[model samples]
Target: MSTEPVLPRVRPEIAALPPYRQGRAASADGFKLSSNENPFEPLPGVVEAVRDEVALNRYPDATAGQLRAALAVRYGVTADDVLVGAGSVSLIAAFLQAAAGPGDEVVYAWRSFEAYPSLTLVAGATSVQVPNRPDGRHDLPAMAAAVTDRTRCIVLCTPNNPTGPIITRAEFEEFLAAVPADVLVILDEAYAEFVTDPEAVDGLGQRVFASHPNVVVLRTFSKAYGLAALRIGYAIGDARVLDAARATLIPLSVTAQAEHAALASLARDAEVRIRVAELVERRDRLVAGLRDAGWDVPDSQSNFVWLPTTDPAVATAFEDAGLMVRPFPDGVRISVGEATSIAPLIDVAKSTILR
Candidate 1:
């Protein structure tokens, strides 16, 4: 006991926080559908572009000006209004750190993004989690009511992760009107490209920040553009707001390779959309098949479908069939993977869960 060494003290919150984990890996022959990832391979042009950025000896441009400019032009925003980071998650952390601190509060919907609670805690802020509706959509009015004077930021995940229903344009507009002007509203549209609903909120089309000025729209190349490995994403908001987030970023976190690849991907927007269309079609078929198999699947507008079942046997059935899916406390999220995966997934449901 006397010879025991003392370790450095860490914050209790930090000590208690469970580290973020990725989706479970699948077996060699299994179709990996746990992660809501683009099933397609990276475009040939994107691969070549990434390869061209081979000057590893040099530090990448910390500001990522080129990529920022490209994004700004596409969104009709100034370069100052755009801020790029390692990924949407990293950019979200930066924005949270910029606006919140000890004793402050961050408001978001529960059963939403897995990272929201961890991000809030890491930012030294309290998370005011509003429960989702029984239908699995965020209760927008309840979220607005949950806001207090202590709330510094609020995050809205459209076509919400895991559960794929989106906040409609009318719903969003009403919610925006109810929230205070000073509180930061983070519109996280990670799966925006997959949305087919005409009524879903379009942060860019509405020019939300133009009038509100408090809203920040976040998007990524990870989901639709298949640039997840590079971890590049960006935000669109007021210049001053984006500046705050920029200040909190780790230096040169966005690599040259990521920038080039994203730029190349953007140049082939038409081709990317074509791939996205294929995935969307697959998702619709999967949903229809699951519904026909007696699953109470939600009307998913994202690249994944939610199976509303807490039965362990359902998850076991999927695993046994060599298909990996993400199981939460209430349901499972199965990404629309290879076209071949659909038949096996539906077969498992019919053979086990539906029985």
Candidate 2:
């Protein structure tokens, strides 16, 4: 038999890893709270900008220069400090690629961003998961202790995914103090906009701390800016760290239309900020209502709440009620949407939990 050369098998780390399973796009009825997407449409200007940005004949700008400039202005930093990519997920993969190597350990909290371990493993790093405390927040001390001579990076997801808890500025400063300076710590702030803590440390500001030279702050236009479909995000860190991170990106990663939409969102950021305030109100209401029904719903600064569940049956109950939520092993993460969108969730909670 004539042999076409067999491609060498996949990398061991990647070959053994399980895939990232995302939430269902279609459900029987009602709203889907699974993905934590902004349940609102893009603002008119952003929508119009995206519509007009069709350029199939040309390649997108590899570095996303225009969007990075706009993000810099919006975040009060120089453009050199900013790096834009296809989505925060893409940036996460690049950061892992830049920071880690085979047999190197990358630490992050369990039940945080679901993608963390997947990307960490795919980049040839060993995943070190720090368990969440009783309140569903990262155990900072434990995470810091997980670092060793072989540790390469750490991901701190504030307003953490699934569990909507933010590490206070004081807590983060302490966490930074505990972590080894050589281990790159990525602060994933994908839901930073929905957060309203008066003393909350913007992840970008933390990247500026000389003591935490390894800190990289990650944020996305998906949640609060209402631009999930456009898939643009930015990371802020030391210029050298950013340089290394950029090297990991494939050619033309961020789309041209996404860049235009991101720029427009930055231009209309004040309006988006106002929208964030409104969503915060809705989040508060959802937490209040759920807690009143005798369920232990964590105080959520993000656009979602975590309900402590003793059984998976309770998770299925939510799905049966024409509502979709992210069911983790220990609990369900229910996203707060538009004021009206949250009504059905409240109704289901009242019917099932209260009565």
Candidate 3:
């Protein structure tokens, strides 16, 4: 008999799917801008809250009741309307799993979030990716046209990842009107705290859930709240919709430390706002500097700016200058990190663009 053991059968689609790739880590002396992370240290209160959770022997509150209640009050919703997950990405996965299955279609913008396609695939659903416009904004009309009877869900990422343009309130409203009432709409506002534009859509303020039973707004404490390490995010929508997502969630994924830290962060909301304001100022300055250097940078309402370059060499050049940025097939995304790193970044941009 052959000594080799047979491998278990695997689904072909799952086998073909590429694992999600994360941003590359930086060297000790380098600035890591590949991930759109908050450069500031965690608030003292947040740190203390995490330390206060000492029950290693006990499992965390699986429902995350305290955190959900807190977020419910903030968003003017009942606790039943909120769903907490390990992160916004996890909530997205749960939503996809809950709503989509084999032969169903999930529509979203291409070159938006890298995880969208994979999430759909994992849910045994088809992805209908509408191409982004020349300005890196979602072509909402095209997306609406793409939806069909097979479509189960639509993901709208504003201040879109990798490309920083936002969907205007008017645009989203019109798109929502065009979409069928039964189809689930996920409004991913991960970077909303950095937005300074008056015209941009605020999903929370818009009361999308109240207006449309199908709409769900996803937000994260990872970016602006500096809780990426803790991995806590929440969704606001109808109780029935959230209940479905809750069914698909990993048991006890949201830790007590994360929930307490999020609560602490909320308590010091004014201080958090100040940190966000500083980052926004830095982002604006960085965009201005790049534009002055003759780069055709987009007007980013997020914490990062996009460089519409297809050149692979640009990323290498940045790495050579001890700055790690995210390089995609269509563009490079450079986050506004430390103030000390800005001079080097600008110098590199000037040299590369001039070349």
- lDDT digits (tens) for residues 95-170 of candidate 2: 8999898889999999888888889878988889989998888898888888899989988888888888888888
Question: Of the candidates shown, which would achieve the greatest lDDT relative to the real structure?
Answer: 3
For candidate 2, report its TM-score.
0.93
**Runs in model 2 with CA error above 4 Å?**
1-8, 26-29, 205-211
Per lDDT, what order, best first? 3, 1, 2
Question: CA lDDT of 56 in candidate 2?
Answer: 73
Question: Global CA lDDT of candidate 3, please?
Answer: 0.92
Model 1 agreement with the true structure over 210-246: per-residue lDDT tens digits: 9889999999999999988999998999999888998
Model 2 per-residue lDDT at 349: 75
lDDT of 1 at 297: 85
Backbone steric clashes in candidate 1, count? 1
Candidate 1, superposed: residue stretches over 4 Å from native:
2-4
Off by over 4 Å in 3: 1-4
Counting clashing residue pairs in each candidate, in order, gives: 1, 0, 0
* Cα lDDT tens digits for candidate 3, 1-355: 9999999989998889889777777899999998999999988777877787747788999999999999889989999999999999999999999999999999999889999999999999999999999888999999999999999999999999878989999999999999999999999999999988888989898787898989999999999998899999999999999999999999999998899999999898899899999999888889989998889998898889899998999888999988999999988999889888888888899988976
